[model samples]
Target: MTATARPAEKPAMPHFSSGPCAKRPGWSVEALKGAAVGRSHRAKVGKTKLAQAIDLTRDVLQVPADWRIGIVPASDTGAVEMAMWSLLGERPLDLLAWESFGSGWVTDALKQLKLKDAREIKAGYGKLPDLSAVNFDHDVVFTWNGTTSGVRVPNGDFIPADREGLTICDATSAAFAQRLPFDKLDVVTFSWQKVLGGEAAHGMLILSPRAVERLETYKPAWPLPKIFRLTSGGKLIEGIFKGETINTPSMLAVEDYIDALQWAKSVGGLDGLVARADANTKAIADFVAKVDFLDFLAEVPETRSNTSVCLTFKDPAVASLDDAGQQAFVKAFTGFLEKEGVAYDIAGYRDAPPGLRIWCGATVETADVEALMPWLAFAFEKTKTEMAQAA
Candidate 1:
């Protein structure tokens, strides 16, 4: 094969993509120096940092006194899976899925575990599953926020307090941006690469006392992996809830998470973070209101997400185009924005419908989101022009 030439230089502009979202202000070189590198995670310094992280999370989130937080293996996915494999065998499961992530959990329950009696409630991308019809007697699994569809559960009011089952929630994008009622939640999971804007590879799992009891009492019929085994021989491993992680962790990533947490504290804690996310979402809402063709993918304002905002065009701008044409147009539009350095990685998920998905998390400023709107308009206009010319 012929050798490929390297690029002479890199592009310069702000990047605003979801998932590995934009970093906090001044998070480049200066931030790296403060990170604890070349150190064992089991060292005293590493343990101290990990403990500080847990404390800060508790402080910012205002978690209950009895609840416990720990760093879990992998990212948010691992945390959720660990909970599923460890504590979900005793009761019938109600898996609610309205979007991609929740659907993934359903797949795990049906295909992976082959659970014959798992009740699956589903809806379209922008809508929520019917919670009123859910059985409170069974264990529940759900994603608090649908990142791909930009929809979220309005609150925990739908959950019944007297229910016998546990509620396991995947709150990766909703952790810092929205309110989560710990009292109603049994197992909550989130990742560092979400609303807090930290590096990936680590997940935080918060367990209520009920979840712990489930882990200690009931064992799954399936074989358990070493990392997912929170209980051994009918005993809760209390040390895991402390600074003791199951496997060796990247100290550098841990330090990065600390930096993000410190940044979260400096900005006035969880309330401030929520306000920032709200402001960004309002900016997009206002823009969407004025635009003729653009509409939010979320069905209702109350259920809309403040972090990931998905949009779809309503006009006949590219309706007549074939699937290939639509794909080409989307590629060109995203490519234009990327090359212009106005935005990065704003493309909708491949499995979802054709649209644009923007990250409006806490770390992203409202001013930056506002600044990018006109560029989106510019890209849309260019794409339309190209499509009309092709016609």
Candidate 2:
């Protein structure tokens, strides 16, 4: 195949990173000029801003009124780890893992927490564990979306409504862009830097009434750190849910989040956010359908992620390469695109299969994704020629 001509137009914003994703449409530093800098987060104005962030999160996510939502430290990882350390030892746990992040939780449960009864239900990249095999009688830990592998749980139907245990979900990549069934999830965690395109360093933890009950009734055998403590004297510290953070917070990042939340609301909130991501993924799907070598890493369309869209080369020549060779190829492929200023951070995750990963979250414009398709084809053809000439 002959190499194609350079694309006439490029994406206006070339930020396609999976984390610290693209900023909301029309976002600017000017939007955060009102950040309450130099003021104590505990003070009236700072506290008001903090409370507003929490309130806006709840409203935009459509969280249940009774659910406790708090802004915690250490982004989504911290939130998920905190939930695991605080809640898992009390029951037999079932940990489902399909990708790096989910597998990390499994290791935390069995090695770090050393829970004797914890069972790992696992699948390789691009597939999901059997949801029917999950025991709802035991506490469950899973990721709503596998950011590395580009697979996601299909829906909440797998979770039994009248379960005997809690469901703790790491929804860092799924929230805002996906329909999360709050009633099915006991604890949900996400970072500010994901679908909403806000700054990092903080995580939002949402707790159903059942999760709170577990917190008050059951305490872990290990000592809890001040940062991870959700309860004191076996009583839920209700203030945290009301914007009283455990430690000082970045007011600037909080302000950025507020701006993103406002943008989310302006775009019709959750429904609109989901629609934008859906459109972005659809554009990529169309592109993949026309291209012979590129295909989704996710074998099942139903489980394919709309946010972190992962792709692999289908050509037997490229697919026949060893792991290191494939990695080198992807590195060169991504570097080629970067050099052209067509994309950035589109490399597949280090732990994932060799391929490309693109962020198609709500903040990414569909027109930009559409414009990017031709460039990908051009890059592939050009890269293939370079590899052949070298051989």
Candidate 3:
């Protein structure tokens, strides 16, 4: 019944979908011009590019010398599954799940792997499971950051350095944008699509010395797929860790990944990436601080994610609504923003609590985030008015 003035500006680049996220600031089709297109991935040129990607990954992420970094198949999921299939079942497993991806791992450990010695520790959305309660003596599997829930373990302080069993971490969303504790983790898996915004299906797997020892000695009871096999003849497959992949790889995608890694070096490596993500998250935090109706889905401030920043309606009028109503509100709010071309794909994960999920990864510009904040408020106001009138 009354007209409202909208925000004067919008985000310059509104391509935030969480996974297969926004590309580098100056990226274009020309960035892939040098791709070894239609060439054999096993050839010298393709191998060189793949090796460069791995080398850049180590140099930029500061991976330790002894650690083995490999380009694997599938995205982060394939890498994580490869680790679980190759490494688990030798010892008792402690599976931890606080979000969807983590929960998928739990299902794999229990229902799929049928690990009778496994125990599951879980927490609801926006909160982390008890890190202190984790049995480090038993092989522990967890996600460093809960992408769907917007919760993350603050640091590696809770994990014991001298633990007997290995630590398998799905660091897909945490890699590049977050500081991973290499010493405390035995196996780490991520994909370039998250922070680097590269093409998907290419997974990166990093293994510690202890994990190598496990592969060399212990074997899972179940059979591993050909591509999932990480060892041969009681020894680790050294070639897999190198540029020689088990399965065929996309030279184009590999080249794009290398391009992204080169860009990462330009931006000052891991520290720079983390700073950029933090700045983007801060832009949202400042906006949330000024608003009474919206708050973080993550209950604890420290646990809030720097990448997949999830927000919820704290206003009683919205919070008191049932699940469907909450979902409807978010749909309306995000739809309004999308119609204005200020933001895109900011909806929370379907399994996550009804709310807004904005990707604040390093590939996104802080100026865009700041510009989009006012548009969020504007959209919310419009959605509230329209919904009320319809009611």
Q: Which candidate has the highest TM-score of all?
A: 2
Give candidate 1 misplaced runs (Cα > 4 Å): 1-13, 320-323
In order, the Cα lDDT scores of the candidates are: 0.85, 0.94, 0.92
- Winning candidate number (lDDT): 2
Q: Write the per-residue lDDT of candidate 1 for residues 130-204, one digit (tens) a residue.
A: 989889799999999998899999999999999899999999999999989999999999999989888888899
**Cα lDDT tens digits for candidate 2, 1-391:** 5668888999988889999899998888999899999999999998899999999998999999999999999999999998999888888999999999999999999999999998999999999999999999999999999999999999999999999999999999999999999999999999999999999999999999999999999989998899999998889999999989998999999999999999999999999999999999999999999989899999999999999999999888789989998888888889998998899999999999999999999999999999999999888888887888887
lDDT of 1 at 46: 75
Q: What does candidate 2 score on TM? A: 0.99
Cα lDDT tens digits, model 3, 160-248, are 99999999999999999999999999999999899899999999999999999999999788888998999999999998878898888
Which candidate model has the greater TM-score, 1 or 2?
A: 2
Query: lDDT of model 2 at residue 354?
Result: 97
> Stretches of candidate 2 above 4 Å error?
none
Query: Clashing pairs in model 1?
Result: none
**Candidate 3 segments exceeding 4 Å error:** 1-4
